[model samples]
Target: MSRFQSKTLCRVGILAAMYVPLALFVGIQFGNVRLSFGSLPVVVGALLYGPLEAALVALVGELLKQLLTYGLTATTVLYLIPPMLRGLVIGAGAVWMWRRGKRLENCRTRCFAVCILAAVCTTIGNTLVNWLDSVLYGYYTFAYVFGDAVYRFGVGMLNAVVVATVAIPLVVLLRRQRVVQEVKRP
Candidate 1:
């Protein structure tokens, strides 16, 4: 494989590895919601590697965690959507910012904004997934679904906060270490 491909895979592997343990142990799960810093590595992967690689990292990491925690079930497939969306939206946003010449190291405001955007998107995605899961599984009635959506959105926001808290420092560190290189001039 080429150097770039190898490096990207390595990043995905390492981040995925980190995500499983965080989700499994460090996170809290109440009912259908999982709030953890697990996705933080995924977001960091997105920032460094872009959406596809980040999505891969999230998918593998979250799938492994779910497999271990709940075993292989139809729900597992349904559950993957939120994290994948999280990675895709966050990673894509970061890449877009980079492509537009926003140096994360030098532009703290832009970095914070990107992180917030990622968090909001992740929250919305998670809320939607929870809503779909409820409806598809017939787990609740209309009133409950609405309440659950709101609750999940709140939980998702907490998760987003955790993701941003972890991701921002990690990104800054990567930039300092020169692991996150400058975007090429267009």
Candidate 2:
């Protein structure tokens, strides 16, 4: 592989490793809080690597968390699909926004745009997944899931906002320090 490809692979591996534990902790803590910061890695991976990498990271992380928690349940596996899809959506949206910002010559604006896009995408994705789960389990009607979806979406948006705000600055700092650049080029 070229130096760039190797470095990119290494970064993705490290980030994927980091995401498992972080996501597990966040998933365990998820309750009344509609969203959690676990999705940040997905967003970052997507922005840096692309949508496929981000989704793979998300899928692996979710599977790892499931294994650690209960060794896998049918319900868990079923629930996992939506979040994976959500991660893809968030990643794709972030990448798009990032590219758009670059084209516009407004890095900060792009970051903000990606943040908002990630939040909304995640919120909508989570709500739909939760609704699907509810339907499959026969616990609630689509309408009820729709209501819960609203709540989950709100929570997801809040989490996205928080993660984006925190992550963008950290990413900027990392960029300034050349950490990401070094990893990409080395």
Which numbered prediction scores highest in lDDT against the true structure? 1
Per model, state how many residue pairs clash.
0, 0
For candidate 2, write residues 1-186 as lDDT tens digits.
998777766766777677776665654334555345566776666655566777777777767766887786556765566546655665566556555544111265655565566566655665666666676777867666675565666666666667667666666666678766622210
State each model's CA lDDT, in order: 0.74, 0.62
TM-score of each: 0.81, 0.72
For each candidate, C-alpha RMSD in Å? 2.9, 4.1
Model 1, residue 101: C-alpha shift (Å): 1.7
Q: List the residue pairs that clash in candidate 1.
A: none
Candidate 1 structure quality by residue, lDDT tens digits, 1-186: 998778767777888999898888887887877777888887787777677888999899989988998899766777777788878877777777777766442455665566666666766665566678787778856676566776776677667766677777788888789976543333
Worst 10 residues of 1 by lDDT: 103-112
Where does candidate 1 stray beyond 4 Å? 28-34, 104-106, 179-186
**Candidate 1 local accuracy as lDDT?**
0.74
Q: Please estimate how well model 2 matches the true structure, expressed as its whole-model Cα lDDT.
A: 0.62
Q: After the best TM-score superposition of candidate 2, give how far the Cα of residue 4 lies from its true spot, in angstroms.
A: 6.2
- Where model 2 places Cα greater than 4 Å from the true spot, the runs are 1-9, 26-31, 75-78, 85-87, 93-106, 142-144, 182-186
